[model samples]
Target: MTKPIYIHGSGCVSVQPTFEAGYFFDHVTSYTQNPVPALDPDYKAFIPALQLRRMNKSMRMAIFASRMAMQQAGITTVDAIITGSGLGCLRDSERFVEALRTDEGSLLNPTPFIQSTHNMAAAALALSLGCKGYNMTYVNNANSFESALLDAMIYLTEHPAATILLGGVDELGERTTQFWDLANYLKRDDATIPTPLIEQATPGEIATEGATFFVASQEPGDHTFGKIRAVETRLEVDAPEIFISGFLQRNGIEAETLDAVVLGYNGDSRYDEIYRTLGSSLFANLPQIAFKHVVGEYDTVVAAALFLALGIFQRQHVPQRLLLNHSSIPPILRRILIYTQRRGQNHSVILVEK
Candidate 1:
């Protein structure tokens, strides 16, 4: 068996005001029409002005989050750097598209075009760290982050390196948001007020984006967040419940043993049922939690869910805002499970223990 990979440090910049150490959703904001923007961080501290002037949104976010994770880990170099992103750099992509349309085949600025690639973030992090051992990026839509995570796990098992930096990042674009609204991927009007993600909602889903980065190693650090015991992905399973049960069983854990189950319940009435089935049936007695409503829905949203679980483990307290059940338990957290899917595809199960 492969040695367990431990999460030594984590950093997040999300939509629910998560820069500091308090409960992020003290006063959750609702979006009736517009997409939520990520909470901005002071980039000057980590990035210089000359470099920041040319960095795109994705690059900036990726570098900032990577630096934060490294600082927390108190390390300067890592064995590898990997990232997953749904839309790449939407800001730069949009610029390239607009230039193509307006210029009508004329030469346009290459800055946007250069930064638009999906692997640009990972490359930028490598350049910033000055350590270029191994770098990769995954663009597998909603499963992108999980794909990167699995790669990191494999690297930890095969390589003798001491550390690795892995992350997920996605940014909302104006044109993309507008397109989603037209296709009814976003909320239409005052159809229903925003509530917890698990609540009944409308045809549209909340569109938002952010970044989360973590440092992982085979040996546990002094301030380790948790250990990733196992990760399993199912493309098309006849019975998701059975698949999940088998996963827990293979990992020597029962349904009742999980301290909490982090679910990806976006407000989309169409797909939230998948999560509801698991939350209401299999993990009913455990403390059920969801974060999509606060940060909105995106392909790499599960990264945020992972960060939330880490926060819960560190504080040993469940935030009242994210709770799907009012039931309380002892303040001792030992294990957590995260389940997520998109349109009943790319179903994933992750087990983490402290």
Candidate 2:
């Protein structure tokens, strides 16, 4: 059996004021743009101005969020750093590509090129923390965060004495957003935060960017937010409910036992039905919650869901903005199951408990 990995602390940087001290999902920051950008925290507080200027959005957010997690965990450094990104340093990548085309293969600026790789965020964390231990970055599309999380669990099980920083970071690119617009992957009309879900669902996602990080170890701490019981991801699932059931069975739990559930209802009509069906059948009696509408959708946005789960564990309350069902809130919130998918693919389920 996989051991539960304890989350000592977590931090997030998203469309909402997730970096704020007491910020939960209660007062979400709404956006009218389709591809909303993440709210920029005072980077000067966490990063040196000179170094911060040289970093791209991914590196900046990753380092800042990881630092927040470490601070909350009361640690100066971690033994290892592992992260995931669906699209790494996208802005830098776009810059490099544009430079290549504009310069006609001539010598080009190397800063963007050097920072464009998928592993740069993890590398940046390692450098910033002086961590020379195991470092990895997963780039498996929307499953990136789950992949990194599963690896973190395995690493902790093998190295019980080690503490690690695990997280996911992704940034928006100008050209990339334009491409998504052309591909009809983004909502152009009625694109607003607190996205109208289910009844007022739209056809495309509201693309955005952000990062979330956690300090984790094999042993539980007094200040531990929660424990990740299990995480599973499937590239394609014919029936999401069945896939979720199988995962729950493997973990020896059932839907009825869960205190609350987090569903990825991003307001896309074509794919929201998967969640709607599950809500009507399996999760009808539970407090169903959501986050993507406020944070917007990104390959690694599910990391924000995990952050929200930890927050729920701490507060033992479900904010009204996130609540999607009429079910009464459980007196004691524990054991939250988070299920998310992008366009009916990369379906993932994470079982969390306080």
Candidate 3:
């Protein structure tokens, strides 16, 4: 039998003021341009000056978020550290490329080169916390974060006493922004687009970056946010409703049991329909919530969504900004089903329960 995993704590660093104490997107952040960068937190609070001086944006965010998660979980160390990212260390990669161009591929700075690897965040976290156990990082596309979640779940199942630090980190890059703009993956700066998602939307999404971490264990605690009932990912699904039914069936849950759904609608017209179709049909009676409009789209943005889900469970209320459609409020917030996709691929379904 597969063991259940429970989330004890979560931390998120995003475009909004998520790092602040008791902040929950109460005030939304806006952007005049596309592919916005995440707001910088006070790195000194988490990392010392000597170490902070050498870290890039993504590393700092990941480390700080991990620290916050550990603090909330009341843990000095974890048995493992698992992270996922699409572009890895984009800022470091850019620095490396720039150095190559300026120096004619000679006199390379080893700092950026060393930190540019995809597993650097996990490795760094492991080193910082002195955790030598199962450290891994998933570099899959949009499903990278979920891939990390899968590994954590399996690890927790076999090691019941183990607590794992799981997270996803992705940062905006100069070259990445430019390339995405060229590929029409970014909303036009000239156009005013309403966010979470726009029913009447243009071709692109609000591209942004962030880092979020959570502490997961096989046992629940007083501070636990909820239990992750199941996680499923599909490369391609012919019918979303049928696919979701199979997923819930595998987990022995009925559609009516879901209290809410955190849908990843990034305001990209090309893919918003994917959520719209499912929302109006299979999950018609369920409260539908979304975050990508506010957080924007990134391979790891769903990491932030997990944080939001924890907030929903803790608060037992849905933020007005995240509610896409009106549904009768459930007596209690118990189960939440999350669905995310990128360009209609790497589709993922995750279930969380209080």
Q: Which candidate leads the pack in lDDT?
A: 2
User: Could you tell me how far off, in angstroms, the CA of residue 156 lies in candidate 3 after the best superposition?
Assistant: 0.8
Ranking by lDDT: 2, 3, 1
lDDT of 2 by residue, 199-287 (tens): 99989999999999999999999889999999999999998888988999999998999999999999999999999999999898999
Q: What tens-digit string does per-residue lDDT give for candidate 3 at 22-119?
A: 99877787777776788888889888999988888888989999999989989888998989999999889988989999999888988898999888
Reference-based lDDT, each prediction: 0.82, 0.93, 0.87
- Ten-residue stretch with the least lDDT total in model 2: 25-34
Q: Which ten residues in a row have the lowest lDDT in candidate 3?
A: 190-199
Encode model 1's per-residue lDDT on 1-354: one tens digit a residue: 566789888878877666555645556655555577787888888889999998887888888888888888888889899889988999889989899999996999988899989998888898888876889999988899988988888888888465899899999898988888888777756423244354556566767789999999888868898888888888776777899999999988898988888887777788788877877789878888888767777888888888888888888877787888865655798899999887668889889888
Off by over 4 Å in 3: 190-196
State the number of backbone clashes in model 1. 0
Model 1 regions more than 4 Å off: 21-33, 191-199
lDDT of 3: 0.87
Best by TM-score: 2
